[model samples]
Structure formats: C-alpha cells, structure tokens
Target: MAALPRQQHPDLLVGLETADDAGVYRLTPEIALIQTVDFFTPIVNDPYLFGQIAAANALSDVYAMGGKPLTAMNILCVSLKMVAKETLQAILTGGMDKIHEAGALLVGGHSVEDPELKYGLSVTGIVHPDRVLANSGARMGDALILTKPLGTGILATASKGRLATPEMEAGMAEVMRTLNRIPEDILIAGHIHAATDITGFGFFGHALEMARGSQVTMTLFASRIPILAAAREFALMGLIPAGSFANRRFCERHLQTAPGIDPLILDLLSDAQTNGGLLLAAAPQAAQGIVTRFQEEGCPAAALVGEITAPGKGIIRVEA
Candidate 1:
C-alpha cells in the first residue's frame, strides 16, 4: 500500500496514507462520509454469535472514526453443502441485530459459495466534517484509555482447538459481540483527541499506528493494562495464536520496554483481538471521567493504560 500511487481528491480527509481505521470523504461543508469493510471466517461455532461478532467488528471502524453508522450491506461466503440453510439464516439474523443496534439500515448484500463459512458487512457512516476524528491526532500529554481487556486472540485460538472451557468461550464471545458505540459517544462528548479500535493487530500494533501517525511516543503502564484472566493461563500453556506473535514482530522494532517485564505479559499486550474495544486518547483532565463513564456504561475493564509523549522516533515505551 505504501508503494501504491497516491490518489488525491480535495475532499478526502483521511485515507490510506495514514494507516487510519477508515476513509473519510467530505460530502458537504457540514458532512463527511466514513466508509470501511471487513470480514473473516467464523471464529466460533455458533452461527448466530459469529454473525453478531462479524457485524460488530465491521461497524466498529465507523465508531473509531468518530462517525454515526448509517447503512450496511451484508457480505457472506458459504458453501451450502457445508453449512445448513438454517445456520446461514441465523448468521444473517444475528448480523441484523447489531446493525439495528447501531441505528444503521441493512441496504443490500452479496454472497458467494465457498467451502469455508465467512460473514461481515460493508458499513457507511457520516460525521460532521470538523468533528471527524482520525487515529493520527493523539497529542502529547493525552491519556490513553482502552475500553476492553486484552487476550481475546489467545482465548479464541484455544476455543477453536477445543482447549478452552465453556465459561471461557462464552466470555470471549460476549466481549466480541459488544459494540464500541457507547464509549465512542462518551469520549466524543468529552475530549477525544484520537481513537482506534483494537482488532487483528493487537494492542501494541494499533497503538503503534497512533504513535506513528501523530509523530509522538506512547508510554504504556504494563501493570495497569487489563487482560482476560484466562488468557494468561492460556498463554502459559502455549495457546497463543500465530497473529499475536506476528503482531509482536511487526511492532517490535519500535517498541521499547522497561526491564523485568514478564515475556507472557508482552505476549498478552500483542494478542490480536476480534471485535475489540475502542482505544481512546483523551486529555489528562478528562481521562478519568472517560473511564468512569465506560464502567458506568458497563465496560468494567476499561482503564487508563498509558499517556502520550512528545514526538520522537514514533515509538512505544512500556513501563513494567
């Protein structure tokens, strides 16, 4: 993508150049359109639950961009012979539930028969041109808050292999199904400097994007980072996913850490997540309030895990 020719249009406020979560294009003086699409194979066994997760994940980008989702088009890839008709219908129904929850209409969709089952949506949203938030606007001294705990990736891999307990599996599923709309709304009303949802890249990978985009450094307090309780055990038992290791490698060059941090903690920090929570960079005075609102709104694990530093080499400094 870096080598691709730049496509310049005056109304394009945010695009591929910044590694932003979504593309924002100005439609008028007061409105800008936010567009994004995402899909992946079923990570869980339940068709309905998988559908909800996929749809929520797709819609999260719009919220991360500080916009209100407007409409969505279903994207399904399934093999009729491999998947039951009822199962496919359940998946669609599950996706619709989340779309409706976001106050977005389901306009249309496309499907293709494939051996592996997959589902997601192409979501479109709108935001005021001046109010649009990009992942690149995190400023020095801003406090970073993560809306959910880490370890979804590790627990998910364990579940896929049938190594996870039913309780653990259910917990992870619920987390993935939860939407970021609440925190986005609260932070936007508070002091949102920049925002991004944690997804396949894991915590550090996404944070790296923010730090690099804003041309600043992010100092993370490892001890305060919330993590799924079972995830640590899974990591110790070697249940970490390939994506987690890949994310570590992807961001290691720019990651600086204090001495004596456990290796497993680092793994958790880079654990790739699914429909994960939003990472908000709020001003110092409003950071605590942002976390309070998240908890009051039902995100018990929300926390202030880090702070932004002056522009440097676009690095992340982890305090053990």
Candidate 2:
C-alpha cells in the first residue's frame, strides 16, 4: 500500500497515510463518508454466527471512525458445489440481521465461487466532517480505554485443537459477535481524542500505530488489561496462534516491557483478535466516567488500560 501513489485531494480527510480503520472523504461542508470492507474465512463452526461476526467486524471500522453506518453490501465467496444452499442462506440472513441492528440498509451485493467460504460486508457511513475520528490524533495525557477483553485468538486456537471447554467456546463466540457501537451520549460526553478498533493487528499492534501516528509514547499497565480467564490457561498450554507471534515480532523493536512482566500476559496482549472492541483515547477527567457508562450499558469488560505519556517515535512501554 505504501508503494501506491498517494492521492491528494482537498476532501480526503483520512487516507492510507496513517493506516487508519477507514477512509474518510468529505462529501459536503457538514458531512463526510466513511468506507471500509473486510471479509475472512470461517473462524467458527456455525455459519450463521460466522456471518454475524464478519458483518460486525466490517461495520466496526465505521464506528471506530465516529461514523454511523447507513448502508451495507454483502461480500461472499464460497463453492456452490461444496456448500449447502441452506448454509449459504443462513450466512446471508445473519449478515442482514446485524446490518439492520446497526440501522443500516443492505441494498445489494456480489458473490463468487471459491474453494473456501468467506463472508463480510462493504459498509458506507456518514459523520460530521469536523467530527471525524482518526487514529493519529491521540494526545499526551489522554487515557486509553478498551471496550472489550483480549484472548479471542488463543481461545479460537484452543477450540480448533479441541482443547477448549464449552464455556470457553461460548465466551469467545459472544465476544466476537458483539458489536462495538458506542452510544451517542457517551461519544458526546467522552471527548475522545482518537479511536481505532482492535482487529487483526492485536492490541499492542494497533496501540503502536496510535503512538507512532501521534508521535508520543504509550505506557500500559499490564495488570489493568482485561483478559478472558480461560485465555491465560490456553496460552500457557501453548495454544497461541501464529498471528500472535507475528504481531509480537512486528511490534517488538518499538516495544519496551518492564522486568518481571508475565510472559503469558504478553502472549495474550499480542493475540490477534477477530471483531474486537474499540480502543478510545479520551480526556483524562472523563475517562473513568466513560468507562462507567460503558459498563452500565452492557460492556462489562470495558476498562482504562493505558495512557499517552510524552512525545516519542511511537514507542510503547509496558509495566507490571
């Protein structure tokens, strides 16, 4: 993507420059369009649930950009000869349900036959031109709040290996299918400086992007990060995903960990998440309140996990 010629225009609010969650283009003086697309092969056994998770994950990019999704189109890839007709219908139905839940219309879509089944959406949303949120605006003294727990990658690996308990599977499914929609009242009250959804990059990977983009160092309290209880056990059992290791390697040079920090915790931090929560950098004074409201609104795992410290070249410092 870096090799592609950079498109410069007066209305391009957010582009490929910062690797933000979505592309924003100003349509008018008051409104801007947020566009993003994501699709992946099955991560769960149930086709319906997989569809819901994929749609939610794709829609999350718009939400992370502080936009409200207005419409979505299905992106499907499957082998018609190999997949059952009922299964395909279930997947489409599931995606439609989530799109409606987000108050967005599913107007149309395109599909193709492939060796593997894949599903997701192409979402278009709108936001105030002045209020577009990008991953590059985090300021020093801002509190980092994560809206969901970590460890989905490890749990999924354990499930694939048949080592995960039923409870663990259920927990992982719930986290993946849940949407990261922040209420309007909280958005207005939180004074968010920057935001991004935790997805394929893992928590540390995305946070590193924010730190680098804002040109500041981030200090994380390892103990404060929320993790699914079973993830630690699975990670210790060596059920970590290959993506987790790659994410760690990608961020290691810029990462600084304090002595005595648990290796298992670091593994969990680097675990690649599917359809994870929104990580918001908010004003310090209102950070706790925003978290409280998130908890009250059914996001029980939401917590303040870190903060921007000082000017730096995208370095992350983790403490026990």
Q: Estimate each model's TM-score.
A: 0.97, 0.98
lDDT of each: 0.91, 0.91
lDDT per residue, candidate 2, 1-320, as tens digits? 99999999999999988899999999999999999999999999888888899999999999999999999999999999999999999899989999998999999999998998899999999988888878888998999999999999999999999998888898998899888887888666649989999988899999999998889999999999999999999899899999999999898889899999987777899999999888899999989998987888767999999999999999999998
* Candidate 1 ranges with C-alpha deviation above 4 Å: 182-190
lDDT tens per residue, model 1, 49-72: 999999999999999988999999
Q: Which candidate number maximizes lDDT?
A: 2
Regions more than 4 Å wrong, model 2:
none
TM-score of 1: 0.97
| Residue 179 of model 2, lDDT score | 81
Minimum summed lDDT over a 10-residue window in model 2 is located at 181-190
